[model samples]
Target: MDELIDHSFKLIAKILYFLVRIFAWLIFEFLYEEIAWWLGWCICRAITLNSRPTVGINGYDEATTTTRFVVCFTGIATIILAGTILAIYISANAT
Candidate 1:
């Protein structure tokens, strides 16, 4: 009985790990890629057109800014969001 319980626990742990990994990959591929690419494109285009857009309260662009700032901001935002999500999962699962 004890061995069975331990095996069950191990299986559950493996499943959880797999789920988290899949979730992370999906987020990186879909959410992260979309936001990063869109931001990169917007930043490059703004730089090409010579516009100065500032970071809005929610990180939206009322106008635009330099390529460096745009890419930096987008990267930072993506990291922050991804980290926040990972933190939430970690904290929730911590026992």
Candidate 2:
């Protein structure tokens, strides 16, 4: 019985580890792509006149420098926070 319990625990742990890894990968990829898109938009807006005519917070000309800065900072901070959470979760499960 004890041996069976030990094996079951090991199997469950391995499954959890794999699931966590997949989840983390998907999350990070999504976040990184989003960040890249935002930063690219910021750069393109700052550099040239080639921008789509749209009116919103993300519009190239509609945003002030401070707004852009805040947006960029928020994106970066979100990525960092996600990384920190992933690290903490994985470490906690590793035991």
Candidate 3:
């Protein structure tokens, strides 16, 4: 009985660890840059009031300093937002 319980706990731990790894990969590898670029584009469009193209005439090959700043800011903001939500969730669920 004790062995069975120990095995079950280990399995649960492994599952949780796997899930965390996948989540981290999704956030850091897959979604972070894409989300940042999208948000930055939107913010730039808003700031420019759609008066001009945010991208260069050469297309996305060029990025203005302001655009870079917006992208970096949005990326950091996203990390902070995710951390805040995770903290709230963990605290709420804490025993």
Lowest-sum lDDT 10-residue window in model 2: 52-61
Per-residue alpha-carbon lDDT of model 3 for 24-93, expressed as tens digits? 9888644545666666566556677875445742333377766655664765686688899999999999
Model 1 TM-score relative to the real fold = 0.52
Of 1 and 3, the candidate ranking higher by TM-score: 1
Give the alpha-carbon lDDT of every model. 0.64, 0.64, 0.68
lDDT, model 2: 0.64
TM-score of each: 0.52, 0.45, 0.43
Best by TM-score: 1
Model 2: runs farther than 4 Å from truth? 47-95
Listing every candidate in turn, what is its Cα RMSD in Å to the true structure after a full C-alpha superposition?
Answer: 12.0, 12.8, 9.3
User: Could you tell me how far off, in angstroms, the CA of residue 43 lies in candidate 2 after the best superposition?
Assistant: 4.3
TM-score-based ranking: 1, 2, 3
Off by over 4 Å in 1: 50-95
lDDT of 2 by residue, 1-95 (tens): 99999999999999999999999998866554456337655544455464522234345347666655555565576567889999999999995
> Which 10 consecutive residues of model 1 have the lowest summed lDDT?
54-63
Q: Rank the candidates by lDDT, best first.
A: 3, 1, 2
Q: Name the TM-score of candidate 2.
A: 0.45
The numbered model that scores best in lDDT is: 3
